[model samples]
Every structure is written in C-alpha cells, then in structure tokens.
Target chain A: MNPNTAWLRKTVALVILIGVWEACADLGYFDPLYMPAPSKVAVALFQLFAQGTIWPHLIATFSAALGGLVVGLVVGTVLGAVAALTPLVGELLAPVMISLNAVPRVVLAPLFVIWFGIGVGSKVALAFILVAVLIFFTVFTGIRDVDRRLVERVITLGGGRGALLREVYGPSVIAWILGNLKVAVGFAFTGAVVGEFVAATKGLGYLLSFAQSSYNAALMLALVVLIMGFVLLLFGLTGLLERRLLRWRG
Target chain B: MLRVDSLALAYGATPVLEGASLEVPSGKFVSLVGPSGSGKSSLLRAVIGLQQPLAGVIETDIGAGDIGMLFQDDALLPWRTAEQNVALGLKLKGVAAGTAIASARQWITRLGLYGLSERFPRELSGGQRKRVALAQVLAREPQLILMDEPFASLDAIVRARVTQDLVRLVELRGISVLLVTHDLEEALALSDVVYLLSHGPRARISGRYEVNLPRPRDVIKARSHPDFAPLLQRLWNDLSREVGERAA
Candidate 1:
C-alpha cells in the first residue's frame, strides 16, 4: 500500500471510532462521570492549556525526561564500551546487566522518591536507570556483533585495539544506538511519569493524581492525550535524526 | 616470498587441514583449489595468522602490515563511501586525512570506478563494490595478497571483467597473491602455479600443476589456450575423485 494512503486510512479509522464513542455518550449508554464524552475531554484539554495551568507541569516533565535521557545515554555508552573492550570488566559486568534487564525496573520509583525526595530529582533518577540499562545492552551487543570479516580487514591493515574501536566498532555502535533511540526516549518518559505518579509536587503525573482523587475522568483523559501527543512528536523527531545519521545504510 | 610447511589446522578436535603446504614466490600468483569441506579457507586463515595452526610453520618475509586480503564477500564498510572505504587502510596506517583521501580517489579511478567515490557500498552494484574492495586492498600497496574465492559471488561476465582487472593491477604492482577457490577454470586462468588439496578428514596437497600460459593474461582468452583445456580436465578429474570418495 502507498504510505500516504495508509496514513489516511488510519486517520479515518480513528475518526470513525471517536465518532462512535461520541454518539454512545450522547445516547446515555454510559455514565458521564466514568466515561466522559470526547467533547467534554476536548473542552478540558483546551481549558487546561488556555488557562496556562499546564505550562509548569509540561516543563517539569520535559526537563526531567530530557535530562535523564542525556545523562543515561552518555554514561551507559561509556560504561558499556568499557565492558565490551575489556574481557575482565565484561565478565564482571555481564550478570549484573542481564539481571537488571530481566526485571521491571520501574518498581524502584518509590525508592528513588525516598532518596531524591518527591521532586524532579526522583523523576530524573528513575528515568536515568530506565534508559541506562537499555542503552548499555545496546552498546554491548553492538560491539560484540561487529562483523568478524570487517575486524580482520582492519587488523590486516595494521589496526591495533584503538584503531579497531575507532574504525570498525565505533560507527557500528552509533548505528545500533540510533536504531534503539526511540525506545530509550520512551523509557525515559516512562520513568519520569511513573516516578511522578508515585510521588511529585508538580508534573503531569501530579495532575493525574489530582484527577484520580477528585474522580475527574475528563481531566485524566486530557492529560493522557497530551502526554501521548508529546511522545509521538519526539518519536517523529528521533526518526528524522536516525535517517540523517544513517544515510549510508540506504 | 611466502611459504607454509607441514601446516596442521583444526577446529577443536575436528581436524581441517593436516600436513598442508604451499608457496607463493614474490611477484607470482598461486592458486589453491579443492573440493568443498577440504579446508581450503582454513589454510588461508592459518597463513594469515587469523587461525592458529595445530602444528607446522609459515614463513614470510612480508612485514606485519604488508599483507592484504580479499574475501568472497566484498566486506566493504556499508557506512563509508567508496572513497572513504578505500582510504581506511591508509588512515589506519597514520596517513593524514587529506593525503589518504586524495590517494583513495586515485585508486578508485584507477580501478575504473570513476565518479563513484561518493557512493556507499549499498548504492553500488556487486561488480562496482568488488572493484572498490580491490581498490581498498591495493591502495595500501601490500607486498602479498590472499584471496578466498573473491569473485565467486559475481556473475560470469562480471567475474571475467573483474579477474581481468585484478590480473592487470596485481601484475602491474608486482604484488604476490595466494588465491583459494574451488573453480578449476579460474585457477587455471589466473595462477602461475596451482595446488589441488585433497578431501579432508585430514586434507593435504594432493597434486600440483604449472601453468605455462603467458603473462599480461586475459582471463577469458587464457581459457581458450590449447593447454588450458587439458590442465582443467586433469584438475577436474582429481577434484571429482575427492568428492566421490567423500560420498562413498
């Protein structure tokens, strides 16, 4: 199928589904308090932005997620590279990384809140842990899976360990990192929001807590939609970055 | 000159090559042909020090950096342009970026890849990629080159053209080659000397032939030489016997 047509079809399907939901709500088949109509959610979304009440929450969430993402990317890459290049380090680090990867690490959000307090620090800490483990695995496997023939070619050309790292493994690792970047971004946001959901003074998750306490279903849906929209926008941007960086792969 | 004497190679307890021996004199091209699973590639790997030998000796006057290799796969870095890929050896050897790139451009053109310097490996055809790989190996000016069925992936026409270019380039530069292939005709056409390896539980050199064919050789025309047919027939018969014994 043509990509544009596929996109158009998806849009039409969503619109039809929303139209059905609105019709059902108008017909009173559901409780308005529990299943707020799409129109009511839209009003709630518009009011949240227009009243300027959501700006601080938006900024808080964005900064924490982005800060954790940057630090995690850099630290994870350095540590993973150190492990991959040194056998002793790799053997020591492997089991720890494997176990970390196997667990649902978000449960540590409460501990992060206790250590960093119920603020941006806690959210950033959670985001960092979530992203770091993911990127560490990406870099470790990327270096290990480098084509053996390419390594041989570099060695035959008089490349030592340093050259092999710079020439053969470096670019390949970057490609792998970029390929996994979207997932990492998603994890970063997840960490931030979930940390806030557990404990926070100000964030989208704080607003979610308020909505839950007041049983305001319309406000809850509005916040959820706003977060989804922002994440999708970031996904599109990262995709552009991937295409630019990996033009050679085409 | 490169020489391997009584080389024995194995992967764990599975012996690949035993008592294998060969030679490639300076400025001469040599070929090693064998049935599949006869450890032809293992011998090449052992000579290059990529694989450790179980026992035996490889003696070479070539410096550690003075050897180049071409594989059946092009092995070009997919992320680098043709020119950059060619320049990789020079860059790794500590050539300044400007000089390395200029020299790479020259080799790219020399290999009939004009105007393709900016193309990545994925953007090039199989034949074009092979030419770039050849340039990559030759740009370093290695004293000896080892090839493992380097042209086996090309179509017959592309193979003929590439072999012609290879012969011309290697001969012009006086670089010795030790090529491993199962193609009897390619071995007969390209080599000054050919060694046939026996089928393995423990494979070793089973037969040898001297190609008296003249130099400045054309790959296609060399095959039509009156002597070409007989040498190919003898090599084929020997190889077929190895395959037949494996079946038995």
Candidate 2:
C-alpha cells in the first residue's frame, strides 16, 4: 500500500474507536468519571494547557528521556565495542549483563528513588538502566558479527586497528544500532513514565498517579495520550535519522 | 621471478603442501591447475602472508609493485560503490581523492563498468561485479596479480568475455599474473604457462604446459584446436585421481 493511504487508514481506525468510546459513555454503559470518553479527555487536555500545568511535566519527561538516552547510547556503544574487540573484557562482562538484563528494570526504580530521591536524577538514572543493556547487546553483536573476510581484506590493504574499526566495524554495527534503537527509544519513555509513577514531584508519571488518586479519569487519559504522542514523535525522528544514516547500505 | 623452495604448508597435522617448490618466470601468466584441496589456494595464501609456511622461502626477486589479490569470493565490500571498490588499492597507496577517483574510473571503463561506476557490488550482475573486481586489482598497477578462482562464479558466456577482457588488459599492462583455477580449459585458455599441482604432504608441480597461444584467443576457437580434447582429458584424469586419493 502507499504510505499515505496506510497512514490515513490508521487515522480512520483510531477515529472509529474514539466514536465508539464516546457513544458508549453517552449511553451510560460506562461511568464517565471512571472511564472518560475521548471527548472528555480532549477537553481535559485543553484545560491542562490553559492552566499552564502540563508544560513542566512535559519538560520533565522530555529531559529525563533525552538525557538518559544520550548517556546510555554513549556508554553502551563504547562498552559494547570494547567487549567486541577485546576477548578478555567480553568474557568478564558477559555474565554481569546477562544477570542484570534478566531482572526487570522496573523492579529497580524504587531503589533508584531511594538512592537519588524523587527528583530528575532518579528518573534519569532509571531510564539509563532501562536502555543500557539493550544498546550494549545490539552494538556488541553488531561488532562481533562483522564480515571476517572484510577484516582480513582491510588488514591486507595495510589498514591498522583504527581503519578496521572505522570502515568495517562502523558500517557493520550501524544497522544493529538502528535496530536496537527501535526498542530502546520506547524503553526510554517507559523509564521516564514509570519513574514518574513511582516517585516524582513533576512529570507525566506523577500526573498519572495524581489522576488516579483524585478519581479524575479524564486527566489520566489526557496525560496518557500526550505521553504516547511524545513517544511517537521521538520514534519518528529516530526512524528518519536511521534512514539518512543507512542510505548507503542499499 | 619468484621461487617457493622447500615449502611446508599444512592445516594442523594435515599437510596441503610439503617440501613444495616452484619457479615462476617474470611477466608471464602462470596458471596453477589442481584438484580442489591440492594446496592451490594455500600456496597463494602463503605467498601473500595469509598463511605461514612451516619451512620455505617465498622469494620475490623483483618487487616493485604492491601485491594485488583477487579473492575467491570477489570480496567486494557490500557497502562500497563500484568506483569506491576499485579505488581501494589507490586508497592504500594514499592517493588524493580526486586523483584516485579519476584513476579508478579510467580502469573501471577499461574493465567494462564505464557507466555503472556509482553502482554498488550488490547492484551489479555477477559478471559485471567480477569485472569490477578485476578493475580493482588492475587499478593497483601491481607487478603481480594473484587470482584465486576469480571467474568461477561467472556463467559460460560472461566468463568468456571477462577472460578476453583480462587478456587485453594484461597485454597492455605487461604485468605478471598468477591465475589459479581448477578448470583446465581456463588454465590453458589464459596462461602462458600452466602448472598442475599434486595433492600434498607435499604438493608438487606435476606437469607444466606452455600455451604460446596467440592474442585474442577465443574460448570457442581454442576448443576446436586438435590439442584441446587431449589436454582436457589429461587434466581430468590427473586432478580426479589426486582428489580421490585425498578423500580416501
């Protein structure tokens, strides 16, 4: 299908679902206070904007996600590269990553909050934890699975370690990095939202918790929609960057 | 001239070439025809430092040009353009980008990729990619080119075209070429001298033939010659026996 038509189809499907939700609420099949209609959520979103209360939460969530993604990406890539290029390091660290990765990162958010407090620091730290293992495995596998002949070819051409890393390893791992980003970007928002839910003074997660406690279903739905929109925006940008960087691979 | 004296090349305990010896005269095409595992590739690898001989001296008497290798698989980088792949040799020589690109394009044209310089290896057909690979080594202006089963992947028609292209290019350049193939016809078709390699604990040069075949030798024309059938049969018998013994 054409990309435009595919996108239009998705939009129409979402509109139909919203129409059903509105009709159900209107007929009293569901309590509007507990399960707000799409219309109620939209009005709640406008009210939040008018009150100027959503900006701080949006900024807080964006900051945590971006900061964590940057740190995780840098450190993960380096660590993964070192593991790939050096056998000793890979062996030493293999078990540690396996064990840590097996544990749900959400299980550690409370620990982060306890240690770093209910601040941006805790949320950022939690997001980093969420993204690091995924990035590391992707990049390490990227480097490890490089073409053996290409490496030998480079060596034959008088290329040293630096050149092998630059030409062969860089190109080989780029695909893996992009593949993992599809998952890791989502994890970044997840880390932020979950961190906010557990303990945070300001953020979408905090709003989610407040909405639940105050029995404001519309506010909660509105915040959830806003967070999903933000995540989708970031995902789209990552895809754009992946396409640009990987154009030559074709 | 090159000499492999008292060479011992093996994989673990299994010897591929033991006490092997060879002498290749300069500026001539020498084809190594042998069974699949008769140390043909090992000899080439050892010469290029891809493998180390247990005992031997691979002496290059006249070494002005860098060694150019055409790998068994073509080995073209998947991400490189036809032009970029050809420019690899020049890149190793540290040529400026403009000069390197121009030189690469010149040889690429000669190698029959005139309009497809910007296409990647994956984009080209098998024969076209092989020609691009040929251009890669030719652009290096090497004193000697070691080709390992370079044309094995091409169909009969494309292979014939590439062989002629190689002959014309070799004639113009006068570079020494060592073409390795299991195909006896290809060996006789291209080389000035053909060395039939025996299976090894020592792979010996069992027999040698001097083609002295005229320029522009066609694959079709060569087959019609009186000597072609006899030559083909001889290689079949020799290489097959060697392979069976190794398998046994």
Interface RMSD of every candidate?
A: 1.1, 2.5
- lDDT value for candidate 1? 0.92
Pairs that collide in candidate 2 are B18-B202
Candidate 2 chain A, poorest ten consecutive residues by summed lDDT:
A151-160
RMSD of 1: 1.6
Candidate 2 is scored at a TM of 0.92
* Clash totals, every prediction: 0, 1
Cα-based lDDT for every prediction: 0.92, 0.83
Compute the lDDT of residue B212 as modeled in candidate 1: 92
**Cα distance off (Å), candidate 1, residue B41:** 1.1
lDDT of 1 by residue, A1-250 (tens): 8886998999999999999999999999879999989999999999999999999999999989998999999988988988998899999998998898898999899999889999899999989999999999999999989999888878777888888888889999999999999999999999888988899988998899889999999999999999999999999999999999999987
| Best by the DockQ measure | 1
Tens digits of lDDT, candidate 2, B20-64: 777677778888988767798889888878898888889986553
Q: Write the per-residue lDDT of candidate 1 for residues B1-248, one digit (tens) a residue.
A: 99999999998999998998888999999999998888998888887778999999999999867888898888888888999999998897778999999999999999899999999999999999999999988988999999999999999998898899999988998999999998889999999999999999799999989999999898899999999999899988888998898889
lDDT, candidate 1, at B118: 99
